[model samples]
Target chain A: MTDPLPTGATIGILGGGQLGRMLSVAAARLGLRTHIYEPGANPPAADVAHAVTTADYTDTDALRAFAQSVDLVTYEFENIPTAALDTVEAIVPIHPNRRALGTSQDRLTEKTFLQELGLTVAPFADVTDAAALEAAIAQIGTPAILKTRRFGYDGKGQARLTSPDDAASALDSLAGAPAVLEGFVSFTAEISVIAARNPQGDIACYDPGENVHRDGILHTTTVPANIPARLRTDAVLLAARILNALDYVGVMGVELFVTPQGLIVNEIAPRVHNSGHWTQNGCTVDQFEQHIRAIAGWPLGDGSRHTDITMENLIGDDMDRVPDLAKDPKCALHLYGKADTKPGRKMGHVNRVTG
Target chain B: MTDPLPTGATIGILGGGQLGRMLSVAAARLGLRTHIYEPGANPPAADVAHAVTTADYTDTDALRAFAQSVDLVTYEFENIPTAALDTVEAIVPIHPNRRALGTSQDRLTEKTFLQELGLTVAPFADVTDAAALEAAIAQIGTPAILKTRRFGYDGKGQARLTSPDDAASALDSLAGAPAVLEGFVSFTAEISVIAARNPQGDIACYDPGENVHRDGILHTTTVPANIPARLRTDAVLLAARILNALDYVGVMGVELFVTPQGLIVNEIAPRVHNSGHWTQNGCTVDQFEQHIRAIAGWPLGDGSRHTDITMENLIGDDMDRVPDLAKDPKCALHLYGKADTKPGRKMGHVNRVTG
Candidate 1:
């Protein structure tokens, strides 16, 4: 709305994880600073951000002070409490808007929204009770996943139903929360499109990267995904449609299941995604800077891939191999400075240029 | 010497300017935290460094406290006070070693050391007084430069001598400080090689970059310099020779004069050079990270150039052009985040990928 943020303006980030850490570094690259607000002490972003506020999201005083100190606000995660958004929105703008956040927070709403856009999504039915679950299973069939409609990530808060006989226990697993029954999507491969749009309606999409997950955690994302040209175009176009629909002002990650029929929307993240980390080495301007530029009202950069890169997440015990990884010229290590690396934790990532 | 610094260990930087700011960012990339020791308030490095100790370099207590907190110490500039190094060195190690620092601090000592290494150097004479200036002028010839023996950068603390008649005024301009009068060489171009070495004697050298200056301040440095392959190899070998001679344990910027006879050593910086900023975009491992890895005792990364680049400094009013520059996808901007820009001050730089 106002002029683009000046060189010294501060961008307020609402989370202090690796994404926030990378965002803080990117902001500093653009001659801007960042203030991180999080509930945890000694968050990963604390080492690099210009300022950090350690307070619960419900703390109105910290939220007000942080909003007042920054020229603009953006977040690293969706599912922020409505009250927290209310406390900050009254003070300053939050990019990717509440509509996108609200839609992505609940699985059912997200699927319905995508279907309405004339895009392919996994067949789904909302379940409110045991009877609804039975009817939905009869309609969508078995081998379906019953996911909590709100607050789920990394394989958490979900159960698998092999047959109708397992429906009651699956619903019980959700602990009385609203849920969605998504029929299994059989596909050849999975890929993600990282897209960005500015406040001015300008949009840019990075090359879709094929993804591989282990134990439901992202393991590797290789750019120039092994897909046909037609599918690549469809992936990018569908992603643009979602960005435009949300009127997004920052980067978003759109995960897709590549079926023979067409690409099906799996999920969407309203922030920079782990799968897009390859941009740090493969493009002149990476996703972090792109998000900062878009949210700061600056022109979007060219997202054309200049090199082939494979971004591999270094989880938990992978830290032990860092000395060997550091010796390789092609591997660019990006560690998050997490004090302790527990099992399944994303300690860092390595962007290895293949060519 | 003991072991490569762990993920959470801190690197204490001795200055808080743009070089230090960049080094801090690179240190964070390797999961290492940085503690910046700066005398000025609100230093450019303060916005990104993990911690900052603001006190004069002469403050022994502050220096001791800072050294005790960080695992290792490294500096951005060569002229750090001996006492400060003494205070820190008593507690922790300083990279590039004090000998390298001591040798590069004074122009006379630096030139003598290079000549002793069997390196080509400009004809020179030490001028202790006005009579010595006249004597040196008579020996080195008419066109020469009278420069302070210690603490000179960016053409500061020097006066040019066109003829014997101007000797008094040039000497008067330098006051009573010890000086050096050097005969100017008729060089075809200026090139710099950024080279690094670790404690184990492993070395890596970046390709030579040709430099251009305006008003005695560096303006641009282009990689794949317009020189024959033989000259390039000579420049790099000479740089490695210097690094090996000093038993260096970090990055060094070696400036050379390309002449008909051979390569001539102009001077050396015991830290990352401005010309090497091009590596940020053109190479997988940049000079900043190379220095951090060397000081941390990690293996040196490949310094191979992957793209052709020209780095241009944006001085003072150049900050006004950032908005337009940001629109160019090929140009990556690196700003210093100085609060105010005075004429001729280094506000930032842009690395344009030429090929």
Candidate 2:
């Protein structure tokens, strides 16, 4: 039997954004310290973390020091470069491992890996060059999406190929980066399963929440998702398969498309995710705290929701409406202390609990 | 109209413990920075706050620097010395006001102030020395309690006078310190109103929660307290009266005894109280976050409980049962991250939501 990990361990997090900010808060509640590493001045997470390293990811010295200071390494986003991970891994354990990062960092690799694991994903083909783009588009057909295999998030670095005329411009839009063409699926809704896996192989998942998006930004997520019980079970099982296959430890968010046929994997986030924010108010264990427990090699927490809940994102200037939102007895508002409300930025969110 | 407070502003917290830890979390969610000013080593709040000052409260230079670094000052505890408040107040605004602190610090002053405000409190008298103790005991009678005038919490610095002989011991036990003799009020139950007062004089009270104490330490708090509508109204009015009297900003916990005659004030916490921990998983706005917002001069939050909730304290070695407690699907656990759990030490607490 493993000796229980004490509470004072430091958790090193890469990507000091809002996700890291929330994660640090969750870690603090469990008596854990968080050291945030980001390559910028005044990232959001810097405000709440115990220690912060404001240096480029390529700063090996800083990375090494951060790794040495922390007991374990986790991340808030999936775009962490291989070199950065390599440096940290040399000194400390990085949960979900480098393979999980490698697989999640690239769209093509993630799809192929999921397919190999017997999970149905959007039909896709790798596009290495102009010829590959044309061939993939021809097979995947019109109205498909052509996206760079790496470094894409919140709809950036991706383009829709609605027609043959849109194909070249779509490929050009990626600026010659390696891409993938994915055939569209007619789905009723999008859902996600936020689950955490411990090193001991224990898995716990918060109920899948149905999500709605506006302009590619998350709008709202409702738990006890309006789906058949079988479909919900399948979504959770698919997440378990992904975690087991990766030997994953830490929280993973598997976004899926709920179609008439069944559930299909859309993407995987090897960290606390936006869709899982509802868990902050809905579940017994929030995704951020769940990730901390997983990486610290502690026992998994209960991941059950005590009530049906809906989480609504307060994007950009929407935070200005907090005063009005406060009037509703059911709303729990969270506003990110971003310096400016730039267009399309996620400022905060509100959780409304329901019976 | 006042211009909106800028996001990313620094908030100075006066105590560094679990309350400040949760406050920091809430502030971060609103995109605000928190700097904790504490006079202790390795405080829990320091683990997550953006900045920390490990200096004595009366250290003027350190207090000046801390005051200058944040937009406003609020505390996690109410026993803060007047000199410390004066030091911070000279440089920055202190929430809940110095008048509130001065009145609440001394039992005699608090009782007199409440009576002057036309609020109901148990009969009490000052006990300065043996002569005064004898006089107070004669008037208040046996079975009264003698407590120090200042600096006491969690049932410390108090002695019960069951008889005239006990009065002398209680008075002598205080070592001739200034004290007060309070006549115990016969009541049915204990409840507290957790509420916030913004700079604009807006007061929002969460529904009262019934409290049960074990060994004078709060053990459980149940929301939507079992009380008549009129009693709940009276409880809220009494709390609002105190906040208005103090011209207080930030959240305050007002403890009361429900007597057959009516309600009587027991005590008041000028900071986030343990009884309000149920809001972490029950209410739309948690008391800590509400306190931060009020102190930061932001608008108060919606104070409502959408679900019935119960909070249970994790005392002493009871923390060893974290795993079992975390396994309960109905429970949400909050650990303080304290290094040791001695007898009567508040290690953590858990909130169980019952819809």
Candidate 3:
């Protein structure tokens, strides 16, 4: 087993989005440095990261050099190419392990994994072709969603099946890609539990936060989610069950649907989750730092929060409100320092705390 | 007056120590960037700053180039040379203006300024020479301190006199430097008020934090200082009075001694101070961000503390306890990432929060 990373050790991060930017800040707080490997120029994480290697993921030499420089590797996104992971894994260890990444990278695998653990998930079936799609639709029924098995995010690469007749259109929307047909489950709220586990099998979960989406993008996440305390406990326990099952070694975002019958697992992110951003202002140790602590082999911090918070994302043109928002005494801004604000782009987030 | 700096603006910081390192993070938090200029190699701020210029302060060309690249100039330390300030000021405005900086740069001047502002301060006299030192010693009386007029910090450049007979040795310890003799005031505690002001004259003051020194250096600072609530108001008022009087455009640390005869102003810092570190864990917006807001023309944040915090400096060997401290859930580590730990060198600090 690897020893806890010492102060000044550099951790290699595979993406340079806002998540990686925040993780860089958290690592800096712990006296550990980070080298961000991203293909884009002037990534949001570059301003705060210790080093940046702007090379495409397919560059084997660049990936090898990046891996050689850092003590270990962890990624902000789960869709990394398997060959790229193989290249870096040959040189250094990658936390949240490849198995966790593999499970989360594909919707079908994620649902099957949860079902195998005796957890409730929307009934889902795999479809590799037209015939297979029709058979899967027959089993999962109408009002289902056809989603790409891999490489999907932010409600992308998915189509809705309103009835048996819409099934053909939904399958065509997938464009011949491997797909998962998830049957509709009526739900009242979508809550996420940001959970973490260390290499030694210790698990910690932040309180569940209810999320509100706008235009298929997360708009806000409110802590102490509007759910019965019992379900809150259920959400946390379910998240822990998944973490332990995967033997996860970093923070994971477990998104669940709160239905009248029971909580149903929707999806999981094998990295610091957007819904957990409120912890930055509400908790003693935030999720980014928790992930850092876990992957560095340090003890997972007590995931206890001291304040109630509502975190709102400043997507695209929402940056205009920053002038007025900066004046809000209760707001703590965490802008991503993105140079431009394209539509649906996550520019920043603000956590408003209440006493 | 300059407009509030826009998103993506770059701030130039002088003295790339832990304070500057933190300011960089805060600027990044606000969607701004920072360029750190320091004479040292691989300064602690280098890892997080967007840019670093390693050049001597007297390297006027480099200084001018650094200033021209940034929207405004701010500093981590107050002992900046007048020539250096002039160079930067000629290109970009410097915050916490020269008046405030000049007043706090010298011990004699600082004490005189405080007294002139109708604030309580220790009885003091200036000594330009050894003969003058003896004369000043007689006026201030025995059991006083002989401190250099300029460039003293962390309890350096000072000698204490227990009695009149020790005057010659105390003066000798200063080696004929211009000095100040101040009669000691026995106080129940030492406290600091971290206050901020923007160009528009708006002011905000954090709650007073009691300080303890060990081996002449700040050891710990506890918020909601162990003092009467009335005195806490007095501390905040005194800090605001000073900031207003100077028209200070950034955060200033006001250290005061709580004596029976009200509070005596010990000294002032024209930049963020170590004693205010607890705000990182206790307040909605920390001192670093507040300072950045002030200098950038943004409104000052609400300096309300939601949690009580105790901030302790990790000096040299104190870093040995970091592993155990990291395991303590309430402790928020802020290591400076210094390469080597020398005796008395501040490697970092930890802020412990309480419910």
Candidate 4:
């Protein structure tokens, strides 16, 4: 028989942003080692990881060596190239699987897959070129968004269409890239359900967090998200259905629009999500550790919330206010030590637990 | 003006155990780096620290290089040899100062210092030999204790004298080392006050925790300790007094015996303590992070506890119960990745919080 994995086995991560940074911290806490693999230059997750590899993602030789050394592979972001994914998966298990990656990487397929499950999704159509863009706009109507099917996050590579006349210019904005057009849903608020699926087919989901956004960057997420109990159950059920369909084996973030009629699927992220940051101070176990446990085949931790929590993101210059905010006995401030305070960068967050 | 130290400055730590391991995790959270300087081989702290210097504490070359490279020095244990301490302090700023170290290193001096501060301490006298022990026991009376002057923890260097007949044997058991005789104070319970003081003279203290010990090793600490409000105030004030007298900087643990009359000071430790581990899951700021902020000259964090907490130490064979303990919704299990779980080793701890 192959060697049984040890409890302190090393886990290799392929992206080194805030997600990876938090993941590395969680891995260390659980008596496991983490090796971060990031492409070139930025400090990213190296500050806290046990080891780091700063080679290009496309370097086949380095990729092979990395896969050979680690017992398992997981990534923070889903934009990993297909070739790099194959190289690593050949030697070790990659959680979320190739099928989930292919579906989430392309918007057209993700929406179609959700529709097949009889789950609610915004009306959408694939747009291959300018001619197709106009036809899709006619079918989905005005007041919509046109987003590139792959490599988009935090509102990047997407443009809103308020009028039919702007369809041609919007297509050019994406530079003739494969895109999807979807009619906008007039929802009252946005909420996210963070769920984790273990390799043993057990699933656990945290309470949905009602989120607020500013300039497409997350501003705050508060638990007991001002939604009806029915809505909350539906959100969790929808997430479970998606994870089961994809055979997901880690934490997946499902964003939903709470409309007057019901909840509609926005998209799915096959990794940890920012909306669950409140768990750092509010729950028995935060999402990061839960993800690591699920991927490692360890038993899942309790995801129960101990108190009502409010989490606010520290964007850009807001980090300077840390000293003033830390004095409040109710707030737990966490600042990501990014070297620069450029505009729109997520510096850190603060969690306030109300008894 | 002297240049301000950068955020990622190296901090040299003198011991490499669970305390140092926890401190290293805290330092990483602040974007700072830690280099542990320990005399033993394969220390637990080496698993997570940025660097480790494994050599005899008396190795001048190793100590010199460690001191030169680090910006400031702190220690996990109070028993560093005087010569070794002098070499390191000559190069970098050692926080909690040498005065604190000298007082804490010996029982006789520590008691004398407490008595001078008008704090209640068990009556004690110096014992140089068996004859002095007999005379000291006559003054302090039976049911007293005889202990070595330095390098004792977990009941390792002390013997209890239940009767006059036990005094001679107890003194002989210590191998004629320098010792102190102490009278036993009638105590109802044991408690600990954890506090931090910065170079700027700012002090923050957490509420006292009621502790239970078995075989002289801490077994559990419960927050919102069953003590009167006035007792907590006195504990805090006593800690602050010791800190100001020593001109201390960094976290300090002041252990006390809660008598029906009032709280009596027993001993003080100049480092993060096991009793305060509940803060990891129950408070806005943990004791480990508070220690780092104090040493880094950063503003202190909030020290409020929202939920009632219970922290249990997982000693030696207790590690085998992790699988069952991890499944508890209220338990936040933390296991240090030590390779061997020999008897008396601090394998890990678990923090359970309840509203």
Candidate 5:
């Protein structure tokens, strides 16, 4: 078993967005300091992190310096550049390993890996060219999503095909990027399981949370999801299977589709997920802390929910309701210290304890 | 009514200790940035704060520059020098006001103020010299405590006078510094109420927590203190009265000695107190966030306890048990990233949720 990190050790985080911001706060709570590395100036995580390095990931010197300054490294996002990883890995250990990141980074790889584990996932086919896309669409049938194999988020870098006739235009919209065509599953509800695994191979999974999205962006996540008890148990087991398969160390968010058939895996986030925000107010040990503990080589904490919570994202103009939300005693508001609020921007979120 | 400060505003914190560290984390959660000001180098709060100014409180130029950079000023401790307050107040508004700090800085002033407000405080007499100490001892009788009037904490600068024969030596033990002789109160238990008040004159109080101390330092605080419903209501009202009298804006900890007759005011802290740390796990909005909201001119959040929580201080050698504690799912550990752990030094705390 790996020895746990001592207090006062620094953890280098690869992103400086809200996830990194929350992770930095969690690291501080555990007596660990965070050094945030991002190319953007005045990133949100810099406000809470112990240190920040503003340099491009491609800058080998900056990456090496950042790695040497910390005991371990973790990334807030899965799409970290391979070159950046190569530079940091030589100096410090990165948790959730490069394999987990590489597998989750590409749609084709993730689907193949899940299938190898005997997990239920939507039928998907790799489409590297227009000819490949045409053949994949014919086999997948109508009403499918063609998503880029990498760097796709918040409904970006994706195109929907309503019928076979629209396949040409849909493939053209992808701009010749390698893509995957996934057959749409008729799911009744969307849910996600936030799971963690320490280096010792101990695993813990929080209860599944029902998710609601608007315009392909997550709007809210409610815990004690209105699913059957068996489904909940299955959701957790499937998440644990993925963690064990990857030999993962850190928190992972596994999004699933609840259908007439069993739960179908949608995607996996190798870091703290937006759907897991409810755990902040509902669980004794939140997902952020769980991730920190796991990456630090500590025993996994209990991810059991103690309270029922509904987490609502305050995107863009939704900040106008902050004053009203602040007045509500049950709402715990978490706002990212972003200077400007643009449309569809996730400015913050509120976790309301319903019970 | 004061207009609420906009998001992304910077809050200046005076002391960079664990309280300041927690306050900085809370401020960031509300989309606010914290600039910590401390005379000590490498203070604990610097790890999480957006900015840190390491300069002496006596440095007028540094204090002015620090205050000018933030929208408002608040403090983690009450013993700030009068000159430091004057310099900072000239640049930006300081929350909880100067009078509140002035009243709580000295034992004599705090006792007098509480008594003036018709609260029950132990009988106290100012002792400036040996002659004054002798007279005060005669009036207060034996089994009283003699403490320095200012700059005393965690039972420091104190002597117990069990009998008349010890009075001369007890007076000399203080080394001729100004002091106060206070007759001890016989009480059944000790409790404290964490209260907050916004600039708009609105107030909120967390349920009183039963406090246990070891070596004159807080050892543990359990919420839903074993008190009668009537006494709980009385505690909240008494705390509100003190906040209103001071015209306080920010959180305050009011310690009370529960006697057979009623609750006697032991003392008051103008900032977040150790006894209020239980709220971090038990309440929707913790004392740190409540203080930030009050200072930012926002509405007070609900202070109702949803779960029973007992917060235990991890002092000095107590950190040795962290490895074992990390295995317990119910124990939420919070550690200050201090390099050295000395006896009586608060290294961190754990909030264990019982319900």
Candidate 6:
């Protein structure tokens, strides 16, 4: 096993968003510094990180320099380009590894990986062309969702077919990009387990949180999710299996669908997820710090929930209610330092201790 | 009343130590930026702050430039030279106000202010010379402590008088500097109330934490301090009175001696106190965030504690235990990014939730 990182070591992060901002703060608490590699100017994480390099991922020179500067590399977003990873990996180690990122990046690959692990996933078929999509639609039946095989997030690059009549238009909307046809499952509710694995293979998972969505974006996540004790245990076990199978050394968010037969795998996020934000107030070690600890080769922190919490995201104009939330005794506000609040933009979040 | 600072306003901190580092992280969570002004070349707070100005306090041009760049100014250390403050106050507002600093800067002034407000304080006398020290010792009696009137911290600049014979040596040790002779009180325990007041006159106080000191330095602070309910109430009220008396607009740490008669004010810190560190895990709004909120003119957060916690300071070699502590489920370690660890230096702290 790798030795833990010494204090003051710099950790390189790939994306510069709210997750990176929060991760930077957590890393600083542990006496670790962060160097952010982002293409955009004035990224939120830059405000708190030790250093920031504003260069595109394709810049191998910049990537190599950034990787060489830090002791190890990790990323906030999972969609890093493969070539960029190869360049960074040559100079420094990246946690959650390239395999984890690759599997989660593509819908078809993620489903196949889960099925291979004997975990129940949505019935899915890969579509390389119009003919392939048509054949997959016939096999999967109507009311299936056609999603771009790669790079789809927050409801983007997805087309829903209500019946067989809509399959042709849905396939046409993909613009010839690779796609996946997934048959819908009737889920009672959606829940996620925020789990972490250290370099030593130790695992810890926080209590499942029931997630609610609005306009295809996460709205809120309430811990002590209304699921049976058996299901909760199974959810945690299944998440641990995935982490161990991937040889993951960081936090991962595993979304699951609760159905009559059993829990079905929805998807996985290779970094700290929005659904786990409540851990910041409800647990001794939050998901951001957990991820940092894992990537830095430190022991995984206890992820037990001590307080029942409800986490609500403040998207776009929702920031207007901040003044009132700030005065709330039970609310803990976490605002990302994003200047402009455009529609659908995640501006901040508040975690309220309910019990 | 001054309007609350809008999001994204820059807050200038005068000192760049651990207190400033934690404060900077808290401010960022609220979408506020921090600019650190430190004379030292690689201050710890610089790692997480939005900007840092490395210039001596005596440099009027640098001080002026730093003040003008931020919306408001605050300091982590109380001993900032009055001249530097005068220079900065000309350009930006400084919270906790000038009076709070002036009063707390001198032991004589602080004791006098508490007495004038009808608050109980240790019997004290200003000692200007050897003869005055002898006279004060005679009046205050043996078992007294002679401390410098200004610029003393962490038990430095203090001499203990075990009996009348020790007075001469104690007085001689002062080297003719202004001093205060304080009569010792027989106290069962020491506790501190972390309190805050906003510009709009809103006040909130966290439950007092019982403190233990070793070698005249804080060792641990356990919340839900083993004190009677009535005394806890009195402690909070007394702390609130001190805030009101100062018209304070920031967090203040009020140390008190739990005596048979009543609580005696030991001293007050104009900034966040080390004793309040347990709030990082036990309270919804920790002292650092409360300080930022008050200084920014935001409504004070609920200072109520939800979980019982014990905070232990990692002084010098105590950092060796961090690896083990990191693996503990209940421990939340906070390490200051100071590269070197000298004896008696506070390197970090850990907050453990007991219940």
Worst 10 residues of 5 chain A by lDDT: A1-10
Q: All candidates: CA RMSD in angstroms?
A: 0.9, 2.1, 1.1, 2.4, 0.8, 0.9
> TM-score of model 2, chain A?
0.97
DockQ of each: 0.84, 0.62, 0.80, 0.50, 0.91, 0.85
Write model 1 residue lDDT over B1-355, tens digit each, in one string. 5788889899999999999999999999999999999999988898889999999999999999999999999999998989999999999999989999999999999999999999999999999998898889989997899999998999998999888998999999998889999998999999999999999889999999999999989999999999999999999999999999999999999999999998999999999999999999999899999999999999998799888999999999999999988999889888887889899999999999898
In model 5, the Cα lDDT at residue A203 comes to 96
- What candidate 1 keeps of the native contacts, as a fraction, is 0.75
Q: What is the DockQ of candidate 3?
A: 0.80
Model 1 stretches astray by more than 4 angstroms: none
Show pairs that collide, candidate 3: none
The residue-level lDDT of candidate 5 at A271 comes to 96
User: Docking category for candidate 3?
Assistant: high
A1-355: candidate 4 lDDT, tens digit per residue: 1232344688999998878888877887777777888896655577666677888879998899988988899999999999999999999989878888899999999999999989999999899998898899889998999999999998999989999999988998999889999898999989999999888888989999999999998899999899999999999999999999998888999999999999999999999999988988888889998898888876777577777888999898887777767667677766655777888998878887765
- Lowest summed lDDT over 10 consecutive residues: which window, candidate 4 chain A? A1-10
Q: What is the C-alpha lDDT of each candidate?
A: 0.94, 0.86, 0.93, 0.86, 0.94, 0.94
Which segments of candidate 3 are over 4 A away from where they belong? none
Better of 1 and 4 by lDDT: 1
Candidate 2 lDDT over A1-355, as tens digits, reads: 2444576778899988889888888887777788999998888888778899999988999999999999888898888878998999999888878899899999988999999999899999999988888898778888899888999998999899778788878988999999999998889999999989998899999899999999987899999899999988888888998999999999999999999888889999998888888887776678888988888777787687766889998887887787777566677776767787878988888888776
Q: Is candidate 2 or candidate 3 better by TM-score?
A: 3
Where does candidate 4 clash, by residue pair?
none
Arrange candidates by DockQ, highest first: which order? Answer: 5, 6, 1, 3, 2, 4
Error of 5 at B191 (Å): 0.7
Highest-scoring model, DockQ = 5
Per-residue lDDT for A1-355 in model 5, tens only?
6579888999999999999999999989999999999999999999999999999989999999999999999999988999999999999999989999999999999999999999999989999988888899879887999999999998999999988887888888998899999998999999999999999889999999999999999999998999999999999999999999999999999999999988999999999999999988998889999999999998778898889999999999999999999999989999999999999999999999888
